[model samples]
Structure formats: structure tokens, C-alpha cells
Target: MLEMAKIVVQKTGEQIPVMYNPTELSLNKTVVLLGQGSNIQFQRVEDDDLTVSLFFDTYEQQIDVRTKTDKIAALTQPTVGTADRREPPVVVFTWAGPLFTGMISKLDQKFTMFLRSGIPVRAELSVTFKRVLTPEEDQHDQGKFNCRQLWLVRENDRLYMIAQKTLGSPDQWRLIAQTNGIYNVLDFPTREDVGRTLVIIDTHGETFNEVGNV
Candidate 1:
């Protein structure tokens, strides 16, 4: 069976299921451009937007279709009392898996069917979701964690021994030596060096060899 699509409110964790699956979905992105013609260049990749059309039908149950559409529409309003939330709520539009994670940026409702009293029985909704990444993801995408850290030297710790303990290979010790200015391996980390520390680079590559290279 085809699974129904749903919108999940990230703040309140409310799952608002769509009555009918959208016939089509669109994902669009715009790039940041600079200069013109011969001097033109791309500055960066800009944000993306996900657009979907949803349909609702409550004619058989004789209820207002707004009861369903209202939930999605309310996502456009800023949360009251939440001083930090000046914009609409962030939500996940999902089916099979997450299709998009964003905030509802635009919404247009069209009444297609109504009862004798003008109560909407069926409606179509056009929704636009603006893309945004969480702070952790944004930082990761920006390579903020490709940094070095400190490793304290313990008693009786040699370079190869430290390498084995910290980097999982005894032979990969030259990386540690070269990165920390430990050219005099024989004269380093003796009993007098028991309480020293070294800067451990959080990277490894084809450039790093297994031995004597330090």
C-alpha cells in the first residue's frame, strides 16, 4: 500500500497527516551570482525551497475541510510567548522518508467544493517550505570541527606507544612527532617528560607515512 504523506511540527512534535497524497512535488534552488557576462562568477550556493500541493476532501463526513488545512496554515504564524521564535515553526515534510526539513514560507488555499451553507468540503493547498539547517549541521558543513586537541603525556609513554594508544597504530607515530615538533624522539617523553602535553591533529592522509619520516 502507498503510505500517506505527513507534516511533522518540529517544536511540538505534532504529525499532521495529509488527506490525499500530492500528485507532484518540486524542489528548487537558487545560486548567488556576482558580476555580469565576461566578469560573472558564482559567489555561493543559496538556499533551496520545497513546494508541494495537498488536497483535502471531507464531503462524505460532512465536516469542514478547514479542520485539516488549518493545522498546516497555523504553522506560518510565530509562536506566542516564545521570545526566540519570531518566524514560523520548522517542520519536516515526510513520506517513505524525510523529503524536506524547513519552515512553511508560503501557503495558498483554494476552496473547490462547499456545502449548501458555503462550508468548505474540499480544498487544495499550495505550500512552500524554506530550507534551513540546524546549527550543528551548519557548523559541520562549514568544517568547524576540523581542529586539533590536546593529549597529555603519561608516565612511560613513548611516541609509538602513544600513537598506538591514541591513533590505533604503533607505526603511525611519525605523524604525531612531526605535528608536535618531536624530532628528537630518543630524547623525548623520558621520566622528566611525564607531565607534558602534545597537540593532536584530527586528520590523516596519503601524505602521512608509517615510519622514520619524522
Candidate 2:
């Protein structure tokens, strides 16, 4: 059986349980790609974003729509009255040992059913979360690099720009293309390459050489 997923708010240390676990969860990730006439270039991928739809109701339940909405709002809101002035609460959704950590980027609620007095009795919340990586996590990921690094295409990213950024020179762009098996030397990269992961070879501090020469 799948374990229930719970959202944990770091600021208030509150754990909000979903009344009915989301039947479907959507995760979105994309790479940056640019379009040129008749050609495509691969770029870098963006961070993962998560979206989940939650249902809340008072049908034979003690918590009403108003109360449940209020609790969720608190988890999504920024903390107040602190001298440090921190960002909005960091939320973690954990289920079956896998976890996603992020801040609530969007919260949309709809009241579906109402009581005779017009009070809301049932609601649905569609929440979107943008992923956040801590410095330690980023460092750990970097440490895992070996002879090759994986790069995700981002918007406005080009092979030369990525080469310069990663290997310290735009002149080494061909190395990237060669490593990724991109043989189209006649045209520039296009939007089709966006969201693609490209393998980047580490030159080991050596100068670029033709694949035939090596």
C-alpha cells in the first residue's frame, strides 16, 4: 500500500495531511532551447516543479472547508514578526520514503459544496511547488561529478555559452557537440533542443583537440 503523503511546514513546524491523497500528481521540468530556421540545438534542463490536487470536505468529517483552508493557508504563507525576515515557509511533501522540498509557488482553491447557510463545506486545492536545493545539496551534487557532467538546456542558452561557462572557453563548444553526438555543424541550435540533457566531457585541464586527432 502507498503511504500517505504529508506536507510539512518548516517555519511553523506544522504537518498538514491530505484528506484524500491526490489521485494524480504532475511534475514538470524543461530544458532551455532556442529556435533558428531549420535547425535544433540541445540546451539544459530546468528544475523540477510539482503540482498536486487535494480535496477537502466536511461530509461526516469534523473539519469544515473554512477550517481546512485556513490551515493550508498558514502552511503556504510567509512567517511574520521575525526580526530575521525569512522567506515563505519551506514545505516538504513526503510519501513512501521519497520527498520533495520546495516553497508553495501557487495555491488555488475552489469551493464546490456549501451548507444551507452558504458556508463552504467542501473545497479543492491545486497547489504548485517550485523546487529548492540547499547549498549543501548543491555541493553534494557537484562532488558527484566525474569525467563528464550532465547539462540541461535552459532558455537563451547556447553551446558556446555553456562551453564558456563550464569549461572556461567558448572555443571549446565543438567538444560539447562532439561529446553529445550533435553533428549538425551547418545550423544553430533550435527550440527542439530545449529540455534535453547533454553530456559534457571534462578535458582534464587539457586543450581541445579534434576527435580524429585523439
Candidate 3:
């Protein structure tokens, strides 16, 4: 009555189904400290990561180790030329519905149970993915230009880290500082500024109506 989970490689446009669905899936959310005190701050959703463990067997399923290895390797391989700075191919993990869309962040494989000829008959693969939010999706919530979000400073909380967690990329930290009128880099939020608030301006550089304190 349920469909098995499958990983689709967009570059090759090939879908590889696992022999057995993973028993568990792990998801993580990012949280920042509001100050040196006991208070904790909740930020916007960061990139969503997914991990899937798969088992490959040749003795029982007629699928050889090489076949499985090649399939997994293809998922991790770079799709574009070296001269191009674009990232590797995007991977989609789907089951009954689309689960995640992103690139493979890590892949671990192990081979065990070899035949007398030294051929591996059984193998295992552990894959992890980092979610990439598209522009449309990034601005989807109340529209980026009109959405207002605030984050409280924490001990050792840097603009870059905050940007990475909130904007999905650390490179956007300058925009955060600029939007908040933080001209002096030395005045950047530190433990002393823990109770201070910083405005999260989206990529469009538009100012939204400010919400209450965090």
C-alpha cells in the first residue's frame, strides 16, 4: 500500500530505488543563543538535510556490487565541465511525493561479504543531502520584500553565521549588516550585544514592516 523511497539524479535523469527503505530519517533545525543568559533563540529554518542508508545485495537480488557502486557514484559525480563554476548536479529524493531537492553533501559506502574470487556480493551506502532553496521558494513566505524577521544576538554570534542560518548562505552577511545600518564592522554584534536585535533582509534588499522584539 506504500511506495518505496527512491533517489533521482537530475543530471542523468535516472532514479535509483533502494532495496529496503531506511528505517529512520534524521532532520535537524538550527537554533541560536539569544544571549549569555539561559535564553535560547529560534531562527528561520536552515537548510534541511536528509540521510538515507541503503543495502545492496547480489546474492539475493541479482544486483552486483559494481552495478550498485556505479549507480551511487553517478549521483555524486559532477555534471558540468571544470571550467564552469556551477555546482554539481541536483539530486531529488522522492517516495510517494517529493521529499527533498538538493545536492549530495556526503556519501559513504562499504563492501562486505565477498565471494571466493574476491568479488563483493553485498554492500552498503550511506548518503546525506543538503537542501537548496530556490529563489521562488525563498521569497514564497509573505514575499521576501514584504516579510520582516528579527534575530537576537548571542555570545560569539557573527553576522556570517547568522546569514548562513537565516539566508541559506553566509555570503549574504554584508546585506544583513547593511540593512541594519551596521556601518562599523568593529561594532558587529558580540556577547555584549546579545540582547540587541538584527533585521533579516532578504536578497531583494527591500525593507519590510518591523515585527516586535524577539
Candidate 4:
């Protein structure tokens, strides 16, 4: 399993602090968040000034993958049907419990992000796992596990449904965190931060629109 590390959010303006309970959030819990759509950016005002904060949380865990025979093989290679699709392995997890409902009101409209700042805006959550180093433990194991990162967008209809089908799992949130570089996932947003620009990619893996000055 993965463990949650610290969370950090980068944005424009001054520094903003994040608050959490160290007891429940100790080193072993998997940090997660829930959403409705691809609009991952949000903002809020504090001290009469506009501050934007990117929302990302972190978790630490080891992904479990099983092996077959005694002869070791490169399991990370792509298969025939899945050939030429050398994308990163992604997992997404959902916070489907009482804590999710409680956090709704806390994040609503109390957030905002500037779209004009042209800065590298990022919100990240992370997970840190203990490293096991032993030959015997490696040879005879139930499965394989490793550190994985993912990029996190909002849980919209398209991504939410697509992830379930593509990844074959709905709550494997580590994939989302890996894609979005979220090591620390619960780093909340502020009022002065600006969101990153959107890049519209086409079917042939080409850019359809100009970036920044579009």
C-alpha cells in the first residue's frame, strides 16, 4: 500500500498556509479527493486580496503486480494489442466516504484562480512508501509494488467514466496523482494563484491551437 507524504501548492502572489490534523493524517493514510469535471482549477479570496491556490494531495503506496515462473522477465514491456502506446501506468482513487461530503462546503466558491498570470501554476499531493531491499523478499513475492505518480484533473463525466474503463479500476487514484505530479494531494487553494494554460491536442498527437497568445 502507498503512504501519504506532504502536500505543496505553487501559485502567484505570497505564500499561503495549509491546515490539517497530523493524527488522522499520519504517515500511512492514502490522501484522496473527489470532483465532478475537468475543471480542476479554483480560487478564493483572503485578507481582501485575490490569491489562487492549486488543489493537490499526496499518498504513499506500493503497487502490487504478480509474477509467474522462476525465470525473470521484463514485465514492464508493452503487449501486442497495446503496442505503440507507451504511456505511463496510471491509477485513480476516490474518496467515497463521509469525509468527502464534509469537504464540499469548505471548498465551494471560497476558491479562484487567475487565468492571465502566465506563471507555472501547480497544486500537488504526494505519497511516500517505505523501500524494501532484500533478494529473498524480491524472488518470492505475492506481487510487485513501486512508487507511481499521476497528473490530477477534476473528476468530470468524460475522465471519470473513461478512467474506469481504461485503467480497469475506478479508485486507483495514484494514477491521477502520478499524471498531475501530485505527491502531496491535500494542499488546498488560495485566492491569488493563477491556473495553468490549457493545451488542446488533436487526434494525431499534434497541437491544434497556439499556446499562451491564443
Best by lDDT: 1
Tens digits of lDDT, candidate 1, 57-111:
9999999999999999999998733576577888999998898999898999999
Q: Write down the worst ten-residue block by lDDT for model 3.
A: 205-214
Runs in model 3 lying further than 4 Å from the true structure: 31-43, 61-63, 140-146, 149-203, 206-214
> Which lDDT tens digits does candidate 4 get at residues 1-214?
4333222111111111222222332222232334548854222111111112223222121211111110011111222135556522221111221111000111112112222433222222222212222443442231222322232333332333433544444443344434444355444221211232212111121221221211
Best by TM-score: 1
What tens-digit string does per-residue lDDT give for candidate 3 at 1-214?
7688888876677888887788877767553335566665433446558888888788765446867666767767666546656566787898887888888889988998787778788888888898877777665532445666699888788887998888777767777777777766566775556788888865564322232211
Error of model 4, residue 15, in angstroms: 72
lDDT, candidates in the order shown: 0.81, 0.74, 0.73, 0.25
Better of 1 and 3 by TM-score: 1
As a whole number from 0 to 100, the lDDT of residue 213 in candidate 2 is: 42
Of 2 and 3, the candidate ahead on lDDT is 2
Write the residue-wise lDDT of candidate 2 on 132-152 in tens digits. 778656533443334477889
Q: What is the lDDT, from 0 to 100, of the residue 24 in candidate 3? A: 78
* Model 1 stretches astray by more than 4 angstroms: 30-43, 140-214
The lDDT ranking, best first, is 1, 2, 3, 4
Q: Count the backbone clashes (under 3 Å) in each candidate.
A: 0, 15, 0, 59
Candidate 3, residue 128: Cα displacement in angstroms equals: 0.7
